[model samples]
Target: MSATTYALGAFILLAYTLEAITGFGSIVIALSLGALLLPIDQLLPVLVPLNICMTGFLVSRHWRLIDRRLLLGMILPGMAIGTLAGYLLLPYLDEVSLKRGFGVLILWFAGRELWRLQRKAPAREHTPNWVMRLATTAAGICHGLFASGGPLLVFALATTTLDKARLRATLVSVWFSLNSLLTLAFLLDGRLVPALPQVLLYAPLLLVGVWLGERLHRRIDERHFRIAIYALLLITGTLLLVGP
Candidate 1:
């Protein structure tokens, strides 16, 4: 591997570890940083499938903890529509524009979450159902475009009734399903085969990340963890906005 490849591996491990702990950020974190090293188009084929593997493992183990009603009844329909639309539109979009737009969205959500955390504000008493629906659909579009929609989805879900465990499990399940669809899209469009070697090469790093993150997940304080995640997102968003 070249120096850049090694750097990407480090990013992959770090991102997947965070995802194992939180269940929704592997792609966003990895893609944001990795884009600095490689084109997002090349990265997406490898990263999206890798995410399916990581989230699939989490979903299998924690399947019982998922909120099936929310998954099947509310989230999937809107997200499915948005994902298809974004995927179909991707070829016409400018890469730099996509990254900048994504950066702005992440900045908004991360800034808001950090502020709320600082104030020690309580969770919202009621998030209108329509708002949540819109968030999920928008999240799917982001996912389809960049495979990095966790922050938006998380922003919406953080206001819901789910506790930490259920939230993590449910989010992982969502990723597993959405990423699987993305993988299929890549396969049909002839993107997956060329990326297969890179995917296999980095697979072991994901295992290491999952092990470490699972251990840390049990020991870390939730509040501190959120601070760390949001802080990272804030940095990532800024980098995406300013990076060449």
Candidate 2:
């Protein structure tokens, strides 16, 4: 496998494992490394379905913890609009610009989270509705355009005081719904449809990745090790932006 493919497969193994142990890490880790290793063109379709599949399992696995009303009220609708807009803008955005833009968002959000964790302060102590709306809209666009937007959405929602379990459920529900719809749009466009088979080819690897990530997450959670996954996200996003 190519270095890029190795990175992607390895990421799936580890990220999925963490999510299995602790739901919150699923989207955050999946998309962060995904943006770096896989070209967004290939990355979006491949990852989105797996995300929906994995996150859906998470929703079922943690059924009691999900916040249904929140998904209905904020994320779903925002994603609908965002995805539509993203599809419209897709032809106009070059890969480098899109990846770079995504990278910046990830890094910025990750930095903020790490800082709050340091100060022993609540990340969502006073986050506003506008922030959530902004996050959902932007994330929807990212997902529609790149099939990866977990870190941004997860970070935005993580502001709430919901416990880790609830946080994971909420994030999963939102992403699954939004990504499902985005996939539909991609089908309509006929651009990413051809890649579905390749996505399936990687399924087993993705599953393995999730399993590995779960193991890592368990160790980290047991030690109460919570660090921002965004530093890498930002750096990658910047790299994408400053591409050769």
Candidate 3:
């Protein structure tokens, strides 16, 4: 295989593994890194299906841990609005500026996370409803527009009182619903079929990565789990900011 193909394989492997371990981030990791090898127009179609499968697997596997209250009350409304608006606005949106703005948002959140880590402050026992609404709304818009919405939602979830398991499970549930919608949207628009062959080609490596990530997930402590998340946000955000 060519070097670019090899890099693509490697990126998918790592990205899927991270998603399996962390609950929500395959697209964020893949798109941020894969953009180096292929244009977003091509990379997004391939990654979207893969993201749904990954999140679906995790959600099913961890179904009992999901916070149904949060999912129904706080996330769905914003997601519904954002998805519709995003689908309608996709053709007219200024993608380059939007991506840079996305990067700035992520970096700002990452900075806040780092500050919290430095101060050793405890996670908040109660994240306000207004904050949850805003985060879910922004995540929905990003999900609808860019398919890279996990970090913003993750940032919001990380602040709550949920333990690592609940947090990961809940995030997976969100992705499952959002990505399912995205996958269907892509299907109706005829973006899914042409991408399937490439997605299948990478399936073996992706499964292997998921298996490895599951192993790592069991070993991660709470502190290290948050650290892993922050690391991903920092890397993905910087890449989005600097990439074309």
TM-score to native of every candidate shown: 0.95, 0.80, 0.87
Error of 3 at 216 (Å): 0.9
The C-alpha stretches of model 1 lying farther than 4 A from their native spots are none
Candidate scoring better on lDDT of 1 and 2: 1
The whole-model C-alpha lDDT of candidate 1 against the native structure comes to 0.88
By TM-score, rank the candidates, best first: 1, 3, 2
Q: Tell how far residue 215 is off in model 3, in angstroms.
A: 1.2
List all candidate RMSDs to the true structure.
Answer: 1.3, 3.1, 2.4
Tens digits of per-residue lDDT, candidate 1, 1-244, equal 6999999999999899989998878988888788777888899999999988988999989999999999998888878888888899899989898788878877887789889989988877677889989988998898889887788888777767887789889999988998999999999999999999999999999899999889988998867887887798899889989987
Q: Pick the candidate with the highest TM-score.
A: 1
Question: Which run of 10 residues does model 2 get worst, by summed lDDT?
Answer: 221-230
Q: Which model scores highest in lDDT?
A: 1
lDDT of model number 2: 0.67
